[model samples]
Target: MTEHPDHGFLTEPEVTPEVRASYDSDVADHGYVMNLSRVWAHSPAAHDRLFELLADLARLGGLTFRQRGILVSAMASTAGDSYCALAWGGRLATEAGDAVAGSVLHHDDAGLEPADAALAAWARAVTRDANATTAEDLEPLRAAGFDDRQIFAITAFVALRRAFSLVNDALGVRPDRQLRDDASPTVREAVSFGRAPADRPS
Candidate 1:
């Protein structure tokens, strides 16, 4: 783990001219630039190049933005990565109009249609143990209507995000202050909204 730098752009980042234009649009759309954006930009050229690659890959995944975000969140939480879980998870919850369970913790097939459940379960299984994933796993997702290409793309995204989580944790990077702060008022109220059901039907 590299030592955390004292510079804001090093420990964090502010907008760079080349990246700012794109970041501005994203912030406008989402109401805030994600903290990852800031952190990545600390190495402007490298980060921008990598982000461009990631953007291309994420687009190839063919899931809706919400779907992609949810898969990432589930994997992060399952892997015990709180920073990734809270960061993207909170954004997902806000986007879903229900910050209560952010995509990280919410997993009920009842809420998803058959196809979505299959996709989500595939994500869970991969996160739990990639070596354990088999053709049988893809079978359910394929039967539920996901194409092979989409499944492969999802697999890629999961792998990429997991790599990202490893970096943040090894660096001992604290959760972004913005996320910690934005996690207030309405966001907090919604995050703590619901309680889990106590009984599990056997």
Candidate 2:
């Protein structure tokens, strides 16, 4: 087993009183705190910057949270980071009351559509081998109804997710309890997809 490196409680930097107070309130609203949130609180500036970018993505990205979460999960898989896929993807799925297994393994649930699946496939490709992705791969997404804005959001979401995955992996940050406890066995199995390669012979 690949053990995650632990940086203790909140791992990015020092948390300020103001940010800490706000963070408590924010996480309380959801009833759980994500490690990513702690990492951002590692530094006040880091927290501010990350929150700003995330807020902008939520407001102007044109993609729904679930769709963006799928892209994040796929990108994490392509990057060979089980921790990331299960951590974020698991929480995202839990919130929707959807099967985390389907999300982590790249399967479409009633929550996701064909177009969303195509975007996920595209995200995996771009995350793994950006240069290798041809225009043909994008045709399905375009034909399925994703406009320029959604496409842009998908691309951006994948890129940022790759960054997020690596940071969490390197720090050995622990995913929240819901990811470990609330996740179904099937979902835990799906995390292996992150360590598996598509090119491997079946």
Candidate 3:
């Protein structure tokens, strides 16, 4: 993986066998080692933990790929997490149609299904200011047909995303060139807030 000098990592951490394996898997799965993979290389166990949590969440959440992208984009954007915003925004654009994804990213829920719009708003409230959310905030979701168990799963997903965002943002980890390049223009435009893209290695 190419290293960006200004990411504020004081020492280059050793790549353990497990880390190398994970990098190999990343390249195979996504065609490149993600920037987050590089940052988490400092602690392979942490890297493993993150993905493990995501895996478990995926099984329990039961949200479609499109729904997950929408939720992740909204939550990440609300929290000013540029990395996840761009990544998931791109996925949303690809999976749910550009117009719908663009609207969500732009913070305009026009034309979105009631369920999607409600989920988007809920994600924002959960990420930016959970205390501001009241029972009223949940009424929309319940009206949109989500049950208590589903609601709990959705909140868990949001919490996990916040955890992911905190790890990357606090450490100055930047978006990878491959990731940025692969995103659609609409997705790229929507994620202009928060951290700047990572500088490439000289």
* Clashing residue pairs for model 3: none
Report the alpha-carbon TM-score of model 3 versus the true structure.
0.91
lDDT of 2 by residue, 12-77 (tens): 545578667757865686565555566556565655676567556655656676766677777776
Task: Return the number of clashes found in candidate 3.
Answer: 0
List the candidates' TM-scores in order: 0.68, 0.73, 0.91
Better of 1 and 2 by lDDT: 2
Instruction: Give lDDT: candidate 3, residue 29.
Output: 88
**By lDDT, who's the top model here?**
3
Q: Which is the leading candidate under TM-score? A: 3
Error of 2 at 68 (Å): 1.8
Query: Candidate 3, residue 24: CA error in Å?
Result: 0.6
1-202: candidate 1 lDDT, tens digit per residue: 5544321224554556856865676578757555445555556576667657667777776777677767766776666665666566667666654443332355545565566566567777888899998788788777876687877877877777777776655544445445545553443333332221112110
